[model samples]
Target: MRHRRPEDRRPPWGVRRTVFSGLVPLVVLFGWFTLAIRLGLPSAEPVGFLPFVFVAFAALVGFGRWLARAGILLALLGLLPVLAVLLGGWTATGDEILLSRGKPVVVLVSAESAHRLKAGLAYTYDVRNPDGSTDSLEPGVGTRLPVGSQVTVVEDPDRLVAPQLAGRQDPAVPLVFACLGTASLVAVVVSTAVAGERRRVRNATTR
Candidate 1:
């Protein structure tokens, strides 16, 4: 038998390489999902998905055979959220959860406009805060409200997402969290589209 170098220990597709790098990470991924949901984690899908992506990315980039396999497992298991969201009858509603409760505040809209998005227009505004401070606020709705208008704005205490016009606050805000897991699915789809577009352009240039 011939002596091999340190790097030769993982022969890319050997039994040891597959077990340590592959099997262990899958176990970790399953644990993340099971424990995250059972313990009530925030954005449970994303919280679990990211670790696997990171580990697998690191492994593939040469952290060693076992670590790489683990990373691969994490990456593979991360797809659970994506599949569930896409196939499950989930729809993107007009409204999203802004805050647990709406705070009633008077805002003087010094400026407002409708900026066009890929699909529709979003209403953005410059409003005067309660303390007489200036700030930029967007109502995330479609409608024309001229400058110098006084309107009610509801800001969440946690400030998790953008504040909305007080009129837009839903009574169910405190009790609901829907559009379930659309974030990761949307991000993945957008990223894939961008990457594919770039690849197409690159291929076209070579011809």
Candidate 2:
């Protein structure tokens, strides 16, 4: 039996390496997503898909055996929220742009009902359109107004997107989702790389 070198015997998933691998990707992703939001980019799907691609590449290159499997699982689970963030961002951005070009009509919409979802509380509203037509609208999450309370909202003339509450276009929701999704992907990459490095070192020592 060949004796393993000191370097090879050291823990591959050391605190420093784990933290470095996790944080670097997270910081980079945060910056990228923030920039995309500022620039009014329709979606961040390309960057969001990077973790999956990286996992596939790692598998091809014979990295960590467990990495490929775990990475794929993590990436898939993370992808849902990432896709949601992008889609919601795209819709919100489009609504803002459209409303900017045209005059937004302010209307008083009464809360029809409120219900709790697994994600959060959601509100349904009874809206009277400028065209004198009545419609029921369920604006996805984040309203605290009591039922029957008349809330002011800017009606989209084209109805391409859901009516947004007046003076309430917040980017915080998307940012939160972006962070969560990115962190999941980062964990996969970092763990996989560390495992692969340890395997390589062990193989070299045994030879």
Best by lDDT: 2
Once superposed on the true structure, which residue ranges of model 1 sit more than 4 Å away at CA? 1-101, 157-161, 170-207
The window of 10 residues in a row where model 2 has the poorest summed lDDT is 40-49
Best by TM-score: 2
Please list all clashing residue pairs in model 1, or write none if there are none.
21-69, 21-70, 22-69, 56-71
Candidate 2 wrong stretches, greater than 4 Å: 1-67, 71-103, 108-111, 118-121, 133-151, 176-180, 193-207
- Provide the clashing-pair count of each candidate structure: 4, 0
Per residue, candidate 1 scores C-alpha lDDT tens digits across 17-93 of 33443444334444543443333222211234455445434533332223322324433433544334322211111
Q: What is the model-wide C-alpha lDDT for candidate 1?
A: 0.46
Q: Give the TM-score of each candidate.
A: 0.40, 0.43
Q: Give the per-residue lDDT digits (tens) of candidate 2, residues 1-207.
A: 998888986665545555564455445544654554444332212244445344434432332234333445545544554455444455456455545743456454654676776778876677665567655555567856554445566554655445655666555565565556555556555766566456656777999
